[model samples]
Target: MIELQMYINGEWKESSNHEKRPIVNPANGEVIAYAPEGTIKDAREAIDVARKTFDEGIWSDLPAVERASYLFKIAGKIEENQEELTRLETLDNGKTLREAGYDILDAAACFRYYAGLITKPDGQTYHVADPMQAMVVREPIGVCGLIVPWNYPLLMSVWKIAPALAAGNTIVFKPSEITPVTPKKLFEIMDEVGIPKGVANMVFGAGPVVGHEIAASSKVDMVSFTGGTKTGKHIMKMAADTMKKVSLELGGKSPNIIFADSDLETSVDYALFGIYSGAGQVCSAGSRILVEESVYDEFVNQFVERANEIKVGPGNDPDSEMGPLVSQQHLEKVLKYIEIGQQEGAKIAAGGNRIVSNGLETGYFVEPTVFVDVQQDMRIVQEEIFGPVVVIQKFKDEEEAIKLANDTDYGLAGAVFTNDGAKALRVIKKLRAGITWINAYHPTYNEAPWGGYKQSGIGRSLGTFGLEEFQEIKQININLQVEPIGWFANKNE
Candidate 1:
């Protein structure tokens, strides 16, 4: 097995305590690699170096365009090593190689997109009446702490890192301990691109030790995290002590509404794509399917037929449609939920068991599952399974659909499928989510704002909004003409 070291202060080294953890490939339960088990001290070292790098202005004080150049170089390196990176990501995360390829390309595009954006110099100038002028300038918030989740590991890391770096901030990033291979490879490319020493660093460890240290540290200026809602809330409370800036992209149980007027084939295909594409591991998975009562039976039939056709196996296999869960613990969690769904009276229309056949006995594989006759309040529908499972329900009308879709704590993402233009707009407006789709699902872009409402998350993470998350705005007001008028006379008078 390959052993990986933590990247800190322009050096690849072991943790302060010299501890290590194994990285398992979920596909076959193989210990493919090992990473440093970083401690609070290691996290502190990363934060301190990042703090010093920002204070020294080695990177943050450079011209915006100059910073963009470094990002461009990083993007180029991703494309050049796409094949190797893709393999590593799939081996680490157990996502299909094709899906990993898409993530790698998207990651590269994100850096390139930020490269172009930083060139614009996101600042504004205004001319007030007469002799007064005002300028609004955006400057980097120093020593940012970025914590990303295990799913889509590299893509999510770049989503946070690209914008933060483009805005001229130094970073101390912590990828999830479950999947650290690709992020390590990414730092290799960052090193090759000659990123200034201490400008960017990576730590490997659990959230309680390394993660909380970064969030609570006084030296860190901001914390951007993408993970579970409970964890996000804990980070928020921790950061409250220092009053550090925070941006979170948290969990979701997004709704996918299908009206009777929608195209059945297209809607069915999109519904499957939204939930099972990543084995339903996505935070924004449309796990709740609310179909119009008139066509509920027909849609469920089609959805189940398609769900059974999905081939689950190792991610390295080019023909496998879905791969294993990230770990055995997660597999058990999903199986328990399936048992709970049965007890709650939700019918298992498709699959409800683990896949241990077809030479896949060792891997943590789960068959694509679909639950029907599911009520809105059922645990399977209300909670995020984060597995290859989905629940289907029937809605009577537009008002009921909207009400059902909004009847959850999460308001991250939702989808509406209907041919009626006016109805699509009207329903989309009523759905309580940051990202809504019409006749489609799970297609996010680089130029649009991506985030959620309510308990879903606190702030946006992509496009111009993402860059602003790592920045602080300053308003500069000046009087062109020298003025002597004052409310109070001089102290001498």
Candidate 2:
């Protein structure tokens, strides 16, 4: 267990109120850290620091290449401390060390990728009404409010921060109350690297208090939020009061379509790992596994077997493949969903009971659950559980598969597994999702754009798309180069 201090105004300080929340390890239900509990007052101070830093034009005025260099430094430092970060994440949030460890690497990669992108330093240059006088520029959108979730805390933090920083926007970030240690460590690392004061400030508080403050803040130019869809809607409404630009990566009810002709082995492997991995807490979890009717039973049998085979325990244990949920509330929520599945007449193929009752002392651990014969409109199939639970439904043809796959308010991510190129491409084209995997799942990269079409999200988060979200484009008019192409605004042409 670690005691973490708040990082604000380029230094570590105790909150004015000096309140602290005990972050418990879900794997063992033990206190892992005493994290600061910040108030709305602290959130305002953090925003002030960010706004002042942006107005000062220290980082924003810097050359893109130089900004990129700083990103590299951060990445290098993260790589150097990967082991410590992995352990911290596992202890703080109840994820396996291996998954959290790789997340650190991915976080470093995101920063490095965004860093390289900012060096381009150009926006628009093309034929205009006045071709010779045409101009283009980019301006930073001042202070950003980054509200991150407990799952994948560090990686998600970097996802919000790196690109915003690369685009020259200072940030007042709020980490979820459950997992506050990683962000503190990240802030400490940034301070060690000499990132300017107010460039990055953090407040530790929950959704209603701290999260709402960031969303409703007039000082913040933009809000980048990742969380449940309902909360995201609340955030959108809150930010709307001030007309702040917002990028929301919300919940998903994504599908995984496995054709009968596909390579069943590889497809099932990624299919199982996709939803079951991370204890099925991923936003992109292929929760709805839509298989061809021919191989549906076989696939379910294998999937259920594989799912039941997983060994669950404390995240610190190297042998533990799955750990506990983040808290008791979440555990109960997942179990309630299991009850919903049974009530909806969906068949539970394997384990559906709680698993932590044995040797586990205090963590929130539940058995991996798989459901079959699920109706398309069942509540369990419709809502996101955010746990190690998956719903399996069958489709007779490609049309049915595509139909079932597209039947959701959330269009975040989906997958189509088939060896036939035509079938795969057909399904890929038909599946209306943000990121559709041809034969894989959860394979997002820093270079590829990641966003949703409908309720899944607002703007892209990674690749060039993520970096540009914080940049406001401006057209520069310079008559020094040439004359106007057409007399639209000026008679001088």
Candidate 3:
């Protein structure tokens, strides 16, 4: 019975014509909330607010320290309502409450990290002989359009909002329609915590409408996106019409390379969680496991056994290790990928088929799946399945392992496990990936920069690397001596 409206200029405004869409809980396929079927008119209004706020308001003109204080306020509000936010995220997105708890913590860390960078000078210079000329100056881009993916809505929101706001740009966020509830909560939080009107706005609808408008908007100076590769390409084309600055963290078919010199039992356990966490919906999920031939059988055997033990239930349940997919469509997509794996000659180790477990037959749930003896060229190996499906391949040696890991178009993330630090280092330098973990998986830190080196993404998303993305540089040549350039004036000076 809850009705959601677009948040524009700090007002909860109804859709222009009251057209609405039903947002269903993927867990039970029941309509949980009614979201606005937002349109071009809504996006335009949001952009107009952003433009006015950016050009005239204190939010866009204030010093970075002041802007960061506002962000800190938002972060504090998020903490105060952490339990409620976690429930909303789990109900809307079908991640376990445990996962939502982790996401809130991550969001808090991202906000704190960006808050600290607010006063960082963009670029510094060791001055040369130009005595009359000063150095570089930092400038903020105007308004930004941030499109967050469904898998990690709140976390991605923090990633986009923190840096852009820290750089003094207004934002219009378009969270995925499937996971719109948390953003609505964020809107409420922003207003409650005294964020200036028009500094932050949000809309809800399918991507073609609201998403297209943001990408093609004249006032939107940049588009930051995280989603699938194919859709990202379309977004790129749409944003290219205006040649807007674009940042994308696209899909990944990242590899987990487990060598014989490593701790097989522990490595395989981490690899299982790496691929199957969040139902393998992470952009950096280790979907492709490349095990050294020396211990391939032993490693995958234990991996499958441990994966079979994971418990799937309602995300709100305190002990559920996994939950349903975001929707039935995504479930079918993952199932089809599992079918393709079987057809492409990959062996199904265990749980390749869906299981309607006790008291949860109505939800869109897929069992934890593991594939064995997968080839490098298989569709299941190359393409991002984006579910709790693992495609395990066996490699002969270190060179072959690195070769298999880097074979895909994706270079988002990969891991190498080895007790031999020397060998791990040697292989690490050869793997083509943005984030490479040694002897572990999914070791992301708020302080370390994260992005893909290849088709996986376009920009970094954390620490100092993330802060600089929203800023543009303007070099200033100051005339220390105000002497007119007369005939006697030194030309060099």
| Best-performing candidate as measured by TM-score | 1
Candidate 1, 323-343: lDDT as tens digits = 888999999999999999999
Considering summed lDDT, which 10 consecutive residues are worst modelled in model 1? 121-130
Q: Candidate 3, residue 234: CA error in Å?
A: 1.6
| Per-residue lDDT over 1-493 for candidate 2, one digit per residue giving the tens place of the 0 to 100 score | 6868877888787777888888888877778778778888888889888888889898899888888888999999999999999999998888998789889999999888988888875667767664356657877889999999988889999999999999888999988898888888888889988898878888888789888999999999999999999999999999999999999999999999999988899988998789877889889998999999999989988888888888888888999888888888898999999998999899999778887466875778888889987899999888889999999898999888888888888899999888899888888888778888888989889998888878898998998788878988887776654644554777554
Best-matching candidate per lDDT? 1
Backbone clashes (count) for model 3: 0
Error of 1 at 414 (Å): 0.6
Per-residue lDDT for 1-493 in model 3, tens only?
5667889998998788688888888788889998888889999999999999999966867877888787788888899999999999999999999999999988887887888778765666545564566678677788999999999989988898889888888899999988888888888887897888999999888899889999998889999888988888888999998989898889898988898988887898889889878988899999988888889889878998898899988898888999888998998899999989889898898788765768677788888998887777899989998999988888988888888889999999988899998999898888788888988899688888888977898988887778777878887777677866576867696
Which residue pairs does candidate 1 place in steric collision?
Answer: none
User: How should the candidates be ordered by TM-score, best one leading?
Assistant: 1, 3, 2
Rate residue 253 of model 2 by lDDT.
92
lDDT of each: 0.94, 0.87, 0.87
Task: Give all candidate RMSDs, comma-separated.
Answer: 1.1, 2.5, 2.3
- The TM-scores of all predictions, comma-separated, are 0.99, 0.96, 0.96
Q: Which window of ten consecutive residues has the lowest lDDT sum in model 3?
A: 124-133
For residue 296, model 1's alpha carbon misses the true position, in angstroms, by 0.7
